[model samples]
Target: MRSRLLFYWISSLLVSGCTRSGSPPALSFSGGLVVAQIVTDSLQLVDPTRQRRIPLVRYFPQPGRGSAHKLKVALLNHAYHGKNTDYKFLADNLVAHGYYVISIQHELPGDEPIAMTENLYQARYPNWERGVQTIRFVLQELAQRQPQLDWQHVLLMGHSNGGDMVMLLAQEHPELRQVQQLISFDNRRVPFPRRPYPRVLSLRSIDQFADAGVLPTPAEQTQFGIELVQLPTTIHNDMWDGATEAQKQQMNAAVSHFIEKK
Candidate 1:
């Protein structure tokens, strides 16, 4: 059966939008600065077997300078209690730079609050486990809907609780190897997945410390080829839209560089 799509799509503005400004400069890509057209679509993927609905806010790259070629895919996960709409600033940035970005909503009303215990890694296992399942369902459905996209370079990015989902998804499903990279913004729980494939780049905040063992050691980082950069001015809460223009610019530069270097 075809997955039901609740389409509420809109063709917003053609950009030069890097920030929420009246008139920002043209955005830069790995190739260089270029004009790009982006569209936003709101939809949900129903998991009939699991009896769950995964809401999604898709930022699609239209035919323009950056998107004329095969567009790379980015799946964004929201933080605990955050709506899929929270990442528009980041999503728009990626879309301008030639990525087909889909921000996923993982939390549903009446769901149990995530644990804040000392042993968060194990205590919150169910939440993280369920997260990957929803993601898997979304990807399967998305492949059907957006078959022309470049899935092989699909990169997963999230902030705080959402960031934790990045590593867990790659860890649990090794065979889901199309994800070329993992970019997490201050995931506080669950140790970094120790694998060579699917490159890892974690942007850490200066104000918050991850749980013990959540971050890899210097040796482990080198062994695993992990790139961990600390953002001196950003805080845990500001990883989303709360970030200042300076903070967003720095974070954006780092993130853009990471995805483009390959």
Candidate 2:
């Protein structure tokens, strides 16, 4: 299924003449073990009757032996049917900063297309729920492999539909309090969580097709402590891998600042 998805995406890109941006260079970690490998990893979670596996791209980073720093995980979800490589720049940046990043692809064939309008958008709630299940499965797998993994500092991030999924997970699952921050890139449909926990940081682009739906009212920002950054004259798609050097740098700066905030 994973191979088929990749093939379908590649073929679609070719036929559409959609040129992909270059991936970031692998991060170098001295005196640290940075294992950067892409593998088709899966587990049967939804149905045990059949061997249905949920595929995920895992980026595992382990500190050098005897290192005191605890490992942190970041799960990044791509937009609806969007290429996972769209998140490559952010993922590489996270890994370079010593985070274990996993970029998830959540679209399957025959699923309802996501839309910015509320009437056309409510139909895709189930898809977002399924994405939540996938994240749970991955987290379960990680726990089994590394029992001591730090959940307190986990980061959840996504773009478009993926950003919606991040919002859903943070709201529905109280166990995710360990998720230190939730960062979204131009997610249009879902409203930000109203809680004050698991700090919310959203980045908005000047989307021509759909509303950004990222900004909180000044009152809401003050009350919930939401952090919003609206990029100047930036396209929504440029927030991901297709970003220019300046855009990428801006994204990095925003994210770095968010992470470093006390």
Candidate 3:
């Protein structure tokens, strides 16, 4: 009889602990996790410079991090055949770390598709140039809309073909002087320009190889402080939404840490 009473009392304690003051347990996201706003605008912006209507996916912290002051900006470009939202994982991480992320859809409906070329660097010139113009216009558009954002410090990230565009833009017109960090995910063709202001990072996939000179030499990397991380078991295609939980965690953590540096 005594034993039964003790067992029942323990069970009751467990039930009460699981329920909070007779209320159902609250749904919890991990502590210090910033919930970001997704698809706030859902609009296709017209870029007169490119004469193309560009679609973009924007993410920002719900209440916004450092809204009183100017928050940083992140411009994410997508891989070839990939949509603007494919890199949500990285965009969300950026927002959590106090950045306003804008993922650009470089390829639009009825646009000329990127294709294989005899010489990738020379052939993709127009595509990359068009992308640069799109980025320039987007920055101008955002300035008009959200002038409070910190235009001095920006982060540029992209995957595959989009990564190529990121590199090209960083090296070309306007010189992206505001860019504090430049990251490319498995961009195989474009040569990473040697620069000092915007620290460079190249996340290489295990399955694909960058064309010769696309990557920096070890000595040059040391000089410029370029960070190159090779993902284990992660292929080029998996850099997007197709990534496994482990891959996503690894990539997200790496990016978060890099951007976290002051």
Candidate 4:
């Protein structure tokens, strides 16, 4: 009986140690690329059907360039193919403006280039829950990897379907109290839990999803503590690209101001 008890104690210790050591260290970026130093391991979620793994890239700001303090931001790509182009541009700009940008390649539809709105809404190929889980997984992974990152300073920015994703994530994962601010571009539909966090920014264009209608009615907006910004001449695609230098400056200013206020 004594020996059995000793063995059980040892086993418990081993289990606890493994649990503490299992998590991977946070990824870091140094030079121009600001590439992630550690490769992300597959993250498992509650819904098995939604389990799909994708790579997340990190773009760290050049040290001592813009802001002395490091700000970690997560940029979620629109549903479509999860290509890194749009995010790459955004990350580069953010990095230039003094931010550590981590952009994720969300699960695409059947490994092909397709619109995420149609696929996610239609339930044609890729599952929407999978994308949702991916965002949660990445956020947790970053928290583990970068202890230096200010949890309260973290921001979530998305475009199109990606915009919708930011709202969904903020609503679902209240436990991730670190995410302080959220910004979405050209997103039409606003889900329940209308108010998420203290600061929310939505930028809509005249074309594409905006053509459908403005979501989160003024009453909902008042309840949610959201700030809505509408650009007159911009379109859905313009939200991603095709913005002139003046427009880009305006966007940069808006985002920078939001971060500063938060």
Candidate 4, residue 171: Cα displacement in angstroms equals: 2.2
TM-score of each: 0.86, 0.75, 0.83, 0.67
Query: Candidate 4 lDDT, tens digit per residue, 174-257?
Result: 776777778887655535246557377766665655422335666666776666666655666766545655555555556655
Off by over 4 Å in 3: 1-40, 64-67
Provide the overall lDDT of each model, using Cα atoms, as 2-decimal numbers: 0.76, 0.65, 0.71, 0.54
Show model 4 residue runs off by greater than 4 Å. Answer: 1-51, 63-68, 96-98, 108-126, 190-192, 196-198, 210-214
Query: What is the lDDT, from 0 to 100, of the residue 40 in candidate 2?
Result: 27
lDDT of 1 by residue, 117-172 (tens): 67788888889888888888888888888888887878899888888887788888
Question: Taking the candidates one at a time, how many backbone clashes does each contain?
Answer: 0, 0, 0, 1
- For model 1, give the 10-residue run with minimal summed lDDT: 1-10
Sorted on lDDT, best first, the list reads 1, 3, 2, 4
Q: How high is the lDDT of residue 219 in model 1?
A: 74
For candidate 3, give the lDDT of residue 94: 65
Top candidate, metric lDDT: 1
